[model samples]
Target: MIEHQLIVSILLIVAICLLLMVSHRIKVAYPVMLVLGGIALSFVPGMPRLRIHPDVIFLVFLPPILYEAAAANSWKELWHWRRIIGSFAFIVVFITALVVGYIANTFIPGFSVALGFLIGGIVSPPDAVSAAAIMKFVKVPRRVSAILEGESLFNDASSLIIVKFALIAIGTGQFVWHQAAASFVWMVIGGAGVGVLLSYVIIKLYKWLPMDENIDTMFSIISPYLMYICAETVEASGVLSVVSGGLYFSYRRILIIGFSSRLRAENVWNFLIFLLNGLAFLFIGLDLPEIMAGLKADGVNLWTATAYGLLITGALVIIRMGAAFSAVFVTRFMSKFITVADSRSQGMAGPLVLGWTGMRGVVSLAAALAIPLYIPGTQTPFPERSMMLYITFVVITLTLVFQGLTLPVLLKWVKFPNYDDHLPPEETERIIRIGMAQASLDFLQRNNKCADVKRSALLNSLVTHWNEQLESEGLATLYDDELRKNYHNILNEQRLWLNKLNNENERVDEEIVRHFIHRIDLEEECLLKE
Candidate 1:
């Protein structure tokens, strides 16, 4: 059995890699491709039905993914769009859940309001992974991306909290509004508090401890899990904990770690997220057969569940569009009374794009799967579990595939308003490069007394380079083939010299030599890219 499981895992990995390659070649979103591939694979005769544990998704896959996403976002941008993000994440999600609940309760026979909310919460939050993957294939404004990213981060917490309360109301056969509301507030505040506290400790540990870059990277890998588990232990929102801690750590990364650690951590996190996200969407496809089978066994009509799914999905999109346009108006109104980054009432393109980008993925599935198999302390099955699962799966598939594919076409169709106030990307990069060059020159000049003749010559060369960078309008383009060739040759020679030194010297550590080689490689890469 174990060997069979191992073979299946290996095959799934191979399949995901192939699907991703195909997605890239064909210009389709990888998540969409992966899901379609997983579905195709599931129908093969004798293929094992894999059931994903909710704990595995929540504990193993979630923390790092959320942390990475949160950390990648610019806190400055998130803050500037806080109002929009807050409305979408909290108000929009709540309203959508209520709408879904109302629809489910009204349409589905014997489906209680609490059960309606259970499914609502399950499907409320749009998956950042899905939206981000789709966005990669389309060109959208930076602000739209920021708002979506920020909304995804917070909405997960809010939606899950709704799930929690709904579950409580179901299990105990009671719904206390005041207690649930108070508990929600505590969970959010407490979760954020836990995250902040853990981040402080982790930051201090990085600063005060004697550790290498590998160890620094390891701490980063562990920090999210620590924050998540700690917060969840207190019955708080683990999502909030990871996000808050991630944001805090991201803001303080330059102070906490060296360049090597940052580079290594970035690469490691990127690969980790890719693998996890790929497997997640693929699993959703794989679970389809089982979900359908459950629905059949429970005597539920497939068409009925699908119709409900479609209805809920349509309602979600409409609600999101309404909320988005309303947010623009609200922002304009609020700007009149208070300071805002941009007060202009932008056109419908931004709101329309934002509205259309709501795609559900792993988080919704995990929440649905997390539902208890039976009512608490009873043999009775949870109300409409199979139906809800089917509906959630339907929503995920339709939104991820339909919206994901259509988004690029929509972007091309909509005429986005251009902002003259903000600097162009190239101009921003140039200004930043100039500032960095000037700072480097100032630092070297201030420390000139510490350099010997050999070091001073190197400093002089660096000084000239920095001056050139400052004067250049853009990145220093490597237009001269001879200079590029000479740079490559020098790098190779340096590597050979380092190898010779390593072979001859017993005092110098091998790791230190490898570090220098890595630095040379980085330099060569930068030069070639220039």
Candidate 2:
């Protein structure tokens, strides 16, 4: 079994890599390709069934993903769209879950409201993994991106909470309205509080402890897990715990982390996220055959299950669209009375895009599979578990494939606004660079930090270089032309010398050459950042 698992893992990685190569040529979203690739590979003979334990995904896969998304976002920007994100994250999730649940209960045979809601909750929140992956290939306004990303980040808590309670209602056959309601409030408050507290303590510890860049980066990775575990231990929402912790730490990263740690952490986190996301989407595809088999064993016809899945998927999309448009309309109507600016009033394109971007991915599958196998008091299996899993799989497939594929076309049709609709990014970045350069020069001069004559002269030279460029073109690139040229010459010289030592003199170890090359690359990167 272990060897089979290893082979499957290796095969999946190779397939993902090949698909990624083709993704750029086809101009399709990478995650979508992974999904298709996974689906395609599953048809191969003797392919092992890849099972993702629900606890593993919820505990292991979720924390870092949530943390990275939360940390990457601008807290201020997220706050600006607080109302819209709130509507989509909390209100839309509840509305969609209830609507889908009620529809499933009414239309589907032998399915109760609890079962309907269980399916509803599983599919409610849009997967950030899918959304982020898709966003890489499309251009949308910053506000639109923020709202979608924010909705994905925060809505998991809302949907997961609903699923948790719905599962309880199903498992125990008891629904305590007041207790459930109170539980929701406590989870939200406690999760956020715990996350914030943990972040504070970690930041202080990071400051007091004498740790290297590697240790600091490791701590950065582990902090999210710690926050998540602490929240779950206290019966709070672990999703929210990860988000809050990620947000706090991300906002304060510049103040607490040194340059080397920040750079290394960024690279490390990026690679990890890519690998995790690829595996997740691939696993979604791999689960298809097993879910189909489950449906068959239960005497459910394939066509019947597919039709049911389609109906639920349709309901999910329609309900989400209605909620999104209604939220925009209501917010616009209320803005008049509140003296607030209506950003969505520009047009319906933004709302339309938001409504259509609801792609479900691994989370729904994990939740569906996580449903208990047997009832607590009886040997009977959980009600509608097979159907639920099948339906969840259908929703994930439909959204990820159909919506994911067409999103780029939709963006082009709508003429999606760029972040720099008002001002281009280069201009903004240049302005920021000028201010930063001026501030650095002022501080160095004021504090007499550059005691050496050459260092002080270099600082003066940089100030003059920036001032000249700003006066001429209102632009100051990261490096002065001469300084950049000099660095390149030095880098070229070092590389050539290393090659000579290795090839001609045979005097240098390969490890030493690689080490020196890495050091030079870092130095060059710093110059580029200047």
Candidate 3:
């Protein structure tokens, strides 16, 4: 049975890869393609039924995914858009849940408000993966991407907290406003504090320990899980824990590890995140069969459940649109009272795009699947559990497919102003390179005055190279085959000399020497790439 399972897993991975390739070729988002492909695969005559375990998703998948997204975010950009992101991530999520709860309670016979809130919480947070995938094919302002990505990082924690409260109310048949509010605040603050504390400890470990890049990268991989589990064990938010920890680690990365580790970790993380996301979307599709089966077992009409899903999805979109536009007005009003960044009106295009990009995915599905099979300490079934799963699945599908596909068209139709006030990318790169070159030149000139003639000549040559780079506006120097050969030979000689010096010099710090070597390696890499 284990061998069979392994083979099946391998086949599914292969299928995901093929679908990803197809998505790229067809200019469709991979999440949409993978989910659609998985659904189609489900209809095959001999296809195995795949069921998603909620614990597996929550424990194994979420921490690293949240951490990666958090780490990738720019602190400056996040701060600049913090108001919008916070509103969307926290306030809008609550509003959407409440609205969804109300709609569900009103329309669905016998469904209580708490149950509606449960489903609302499940679907409130938008998954960044689908929107990001779609945005790759379109030209969007940087602020839009930053806002969406930032919102996604925090919103998961907020929505899950709502789910937690709703579950508590349903299970125990009580809801207290003040206690729940206080608990929510504690969860956010405590989770963030836990993450920051753990990250500091890990950073110290990286600095104090005698470890290589591989060991450092391994520690980084474990850090998120440590933060998440630790926070959740204390009844705090694991999602917030991972996000805060990731952000802290990213900010302190240079202090904790050298360049080689950063390079290796980036490659490793990119591949890991890709595999995880692909499997997640694919699983969403594959799980459809199991969800349908559950609905059938419960004697719920498939059409009726689907209609409910559609209605909920429609309501979600409307609520998000209203919230998105309302945010602009709110920001404007708040700017009058205090400091604000870009208080200028964003107009309809930006909000419309933001509103339309509310694609739901793995988190919602996982949360729905996690609903208890029966009430605590009893055999009585959880009310409307299967129907909730079916509806959540429907919402995820419609949003991902419809919104994901239509996003590119929306971008083409809407004209977004240049939201970035900074210099163009090329100009920015040129300025940064020139500044680095100047700094290097100054450092070398100050240190090399007392050096021998041979060393002085070599240092002078490097100084000239920097001067040439400055004059050429930071462009690489044109090189012939002979020049390239000689340049590489010179670099090889430097490596040999450095290695000999390291071996002979007991006074030298090996870490400092290694840092220099890493810089040389990067330079050589750039040259080779050119």
Estimate the Cα RMSD of every predicted model relative to the unseen true structure: 9.0, 9.9, 7.6
TM-score on alpha carbons, each prediction: 0.88, 0.87, 0.89
lDDT of 3 by residue, 19-79 (tens): 9999999999999999999999999899889878999889999999999998877665677
Which of candidates 2 and 3 is the stronger one according to lDDT? 3
Number of the predicted model whose lDDT against the real structure is largest: 3
lDDT (Cα, tens digit) per residue for candidate 2, span 376-481: 5779888778898989988998999999998888887985433232245455435434443454445545545455324444434655664554421222343456
**Candidate 1 vs candidate 2: which has greater lDDT?**
1
Q: Candidate 2: lDDT of 235?
A: 99
Model 3: lDDT of residue 255: 45
How does candidate 1 fare on TM-score?
Answer: 0.88
**lDDT of all predictions, in order shown?**
0.81, 0.77, 0.83
Q: lDDT (0-100) at residue 186 of candidate 3?
A: 90
- Which portions of model 3 miss their true places by more than 4 Å? 446-459, 468-521, 524-530
Q: In model 2, which runs have C-alpha deviations exceeding 4 angstroms?
A: 339-344, 416-423, 449-457, 469-530
